[model samples]
Target: MKAEHQNLYQPHKGGTLCKMLFPVLLLTLFFPLGHAQSSMSPEFSIIKPRHSRLLKSALQRETSAFLLSDPWAPLENQGWRSCVESRNGPALPEKSEGYIQVFLDGGLNQQRMGICDAVAVAKILNATLVIPYLEVNPVWKDSSSFEDIYDVDHFIDVLKDDVSIVKELPEEYSWSTREYYATAIRDNRIKVAPVHASANWYLENVLPVLRSYGVAAISPFSHRLSFDNLPMDIQRLRCKVNFQALTFVPHIRTLGDALISRLRYPQDPLKVTAAGDKEMAGKFVVLHLRFDKDMAAHSACDFGGGKAEKLALAKYRQVIWQGRVLNSQFTDEELRSLGRCPMTPEEVGLLLAALGFDNSTRLYLASHKVYGGEARISTLRELFPLMEDKKNLASSEERSQIKGKASLLAAVDYYVGMHSDIFISASPGNMHNAMVGHRTYLNLKTIKPSMALMGQLFLNKNISWSDFQQSVVEGHQNRQGQIRLRKPKQSIYTYPAPDCMCQA
Candidate 1:
């Protein structure tokens, strides 16, 4: 195993050891080796043999007698409440302008945002919306449509007053399909809709098409709508779509409920109990561990996986993105300082430890296959032995419905995440963004980690565990479930304040 590990790190023929050492030496010149690892507490040290130098140095730190506080304590919501004021919005037009179709791309969350935008766009155009087409995710290869994941009847029924949504196109427009638009760019197909496009842009571009053909189909409709400058009603409608209209199919919800039940009451493994059974139930924290291989490679940050991991990620980047990753230009230390790097499983585990979460904490690992697999998450598992995920909590037969389907699996996680007593993401991504906004609307406790502070703290070799804990607590004081009003051009989906919330 040692020989294999060494062989994995060996460079091509004629490459000297100095070549590999040069980058490390260069990094040390700016940021010394002393700043790399000593910052972590000894209690959270990883036990892996071939770990990062940062974890290796953690083993050398003096043990501190720090006790876990009641980390499961509920947080107070400052005077704001979720009040989506759509009552004052303009009433939907009795007569529709035409049919509006959107072919949404990306993962479940991205498509979810698109669905909200499509509804908003339909209202903007006074057009009837055909159920938005969910493009097969290229990465997950999931061909699940909108109906497959969401309760379509509920979706239409909830949004009936806000916008007109249909199950499919009219028979007259049956010829208007995804393939029809792909074969040749018809004038009716608005394919060039820019990212975060203003309402006026859609009126100028799409209204004419609706007038001409009685229908318009927008392909690649992910993030094509603007987050700002829209009417208040439009913004509120978007929120309604996200928070109320979009609900998982019955099976996904059932699975999610089952997982939540198991998390709250772990003693009865064979028998899933009701969520209301509080006698033996415990609160669980949903940790959306977003550290996947694609995210790791795209971030272009070193994760202490050594040279072999680096080489493998580089190859992956080349194959997938043609080496066009922008973060590749910066050093790992620079990225960490800027908070551009994704927190590793070990680092996030340490964060949980520093924030008072201990071995007794019930942690739900909400993620797909983590970048390095089980070996990568072994340290985290060691930290929280009672951790659970979909596979572990649900039987293989229970998981069969969502098996091999990324969107359905993600929907399950999303459902479970929404019901978690507390939610914290290892790093920010689509799922994190969705959960943050949804939890905020419901005024639930959601911890948004201060990445820059965490990076700086982690980089400090001399900082003790107590100091680290204080800094973390102080830095995150204002970040927990606080209603941050949406700034100009900021995502309403992520920050649902002022638009989706009303002062109490």
Candidate 2:
């Protein structure tokens, strides 16, 4: 067996298993028992988490048999098709109003969300958006401009009806830039927002000021525009900006698209016909493996690692994550129970195995180099021997195109994941959120593990592979492609689901 990943298991995540024992349906239709795991397969012996009340009703949640009703369910009232068709609105006048200047920078996900907010704000304020400035992180200080990574002309053309966009300020303002400019808030050199500003907030608070001053210079300029009770038009416009307007630079897009085609239609007929390899023919899963040093530390999951690994990750966290370790109120144990940590690669391997994916199942891992390198991924490699990443899959010439280009490389990951048949995220980070919204926007399925159930089932030493597969398939039948709804309304800004996502 692989090194024990005991740390990945929390202190019984689900509430107390209901005292009244109930029998579960033993058979699963989709995955037959005869086709299940061989008895010779790896058997993991785990020290089961002591049952806590949080994981109650585990044995009897589903009282009766149920079949999958719809493979693709939708969010009601999002009306994306209607909204995109009805996008004609009064934009800012050509010669009259001031400008809404936004600076977009960060890793790919942050910048992607920023672009949406900037476009939505421009629509709200009825001000022309000066070509939003794009900044690269100093970590990977590639001197790539916005146009270098994205098709600037395509952006302007796609959003022509939504708002007037310009690469730079007009000649008049270029000469007297400081004189014509006004910042988002009263402070000349500062930006202010007490909360994730609402579209109405922009319309009411910022628009009048833009009209008065003819230019609003917003710094850190884009993020967290609201989605809740705001006008439907604003929500729809956000979707358009995210899915339609922003596109990768031509060459990078071409590479990603070519990769997509290959995955969708592998040339080898044997790959299509082979028992385990049939899953590779099209729609391979993209595992956004987030086991990087920074992510693990921020999650406070002190999973197996030596003192050097711990210290290295801790120190790295202090430098990158807001210049300090995230001082969460919860303890590491508590965090694990809450599913706050990324699943260990071993845990993920077991998960896919339980889901019936085998060694030959094609899995494109969209990630940075796995932390702890090959040793850490050893267990996962045993389960998924054919897993591929950019390093393994790309040709030397293709690798050169994305080498040293972090943003463009991230774009490639995004496109590949976006087109995959299933996208399984290690954690719900920016990559997951961004891709989930886009995939949801396109009415596609994304399989998110129900950790609550997994935490319970994995504990039972007597649980067979067939029973586990039955539980997972039945549990998640409707979960895939389900219209995501915001639970607590405040989370919409960060999550932007159902709001940023719409059913056509």
TM-score for each of the candidates: 0.86, 0.73
Per-residue accuracy of model 2 over 371-489 as CA lDDT, tens digit each: 65666676676667767787876778988988988888888999888778778887777887787767766656677776656655655656655466577668776556565566645
Please report how far candidate 2 places residue 318 from its true position, in Å: 6.2
Per-model CA lDDT versus the true structure: 0.81, 0.62
RMSD of model 1 against the true structure: 9.1
Error of 2 at 408 (Å): 0.6
Candidate 1 least-lDDT 10 residues: 35-44
Which lDDT value does model 1 have at 213? Answer: 98
Clashing residue pairs for model 2: 14-54, 14-55, 15-53, 15-54, 15-55, 15-56, 16-53, 16-56, 18-57, 98-214
